[model samples]
Target: MIDSCRSKADFAALRRGRRFDSELLWMSFAADAGLARPRVAFALSRHAGTAVVRNRVRRRLRALFREHADDLAPGRYLVGTRGAASAVTYRRARAELARLLETAGAFPRIKRTPT
Candidate 1:
């Protein structure tokens, strides 16, 4: 399961982390050897939209993160939503996030076996 980054230190550390950006969102990642799973935090500025819009986007992003939690590397991720993110469909958002994570090498390669 993915954990939420709740501590001030965790958020602070993201400032020093490697960053990746896309039209929908920008992300920062910092590897942590002590982590058993990926931890994430979200940021949405007022420019994103009204409170309702921001919450909707946050919920969508959270669901997408949960679906990919197992694939993610052990790290802390800070995800900031762009205005476009508040307007996209869930499928498009998912696609963008997948591409972003892939570009960041956040998802490790898994071997497959033929049955």
Candidate 2:
């Protein structure tokens, strides 16, 4: 299950973890050996936009993470965004987020051949 990073320490730890930037967002993630599931937090700064835009961005990020929570490695992940993120479509956000996750080694190595 995908859980929220509720503590300041956990957020700090993720902030210090692996960092990657997509066109629309920034992602920081660190693998946790002890974690039974992945935890995630979204940081939409005031500079990003107005309250409505920020909340929209937050909702999209959370949805993207939750939808793929089962595929992610056990870790603490934090996603942040700038004003540009507010303009992105859900499809683009998901695609970029997936790329970041893959680069962070969040997926298993299982492969399937083309039929």
Candidate 3:
């Protein structure tokens, strides 16, 4: 199961971790020595939109993150949105998030055998 970063300390640590950005999102990641799966937190702010819009964007991102939790490396991750995120569609969010994960090199590498 995907873990949630529920403490301020954990969130602070993530803030100090490596950061990545895209047109739709901003993310931070750091290795979590104590976890076997990645933990994620959302930091959507009022700047993103009204309460309804922010929650919608947050939920979409969380869903995308959960779908790939197993594929992600064990770490503490935080995803936040800018003013533009609320304007994005689910498909765009999913595709952009996937690209962000790839840029972070967070997915495990697969070994191939010569055939």
TM-score of each: 0.89, 0.88, 0.87
What digit string (tens of lDDT, one per residue) describes model 3 on residues 60-114? Answer: 9889988887778888888987566567789988887888888887886445479
lDDT of 3 at 17: 88
How many clashes does each candidate structure show, in the order listed? 0, 0, 0
Ranking by lDDT: 1, 2, 3
Candidate 1, which ten residues in sequence have the lowest lDDT sum?
80-89
Using TM-score as the measure, name the better of candidate 1 and candidate 3.
1
lDDT of 2 by residue, 23-46 (tens): 777889988878888989888878
Provide the overall lDDT of each model, using Cα atoms, as 2-decimal numbers: 0.85, 0.84, 0.83
Q: Which regions of candidate 2 fall more than 4 Å away from where they truly are?
A: 109-115
Q: Write the per-residue lDDT of candidate 1 for residues 1-115, one digit (tens) a residue.
A: 9999999888878888899998878889887768888899998888888888888988999999999987888889988877755676799889888988988888874455799
Off by over 4 Å in 1: 112-115
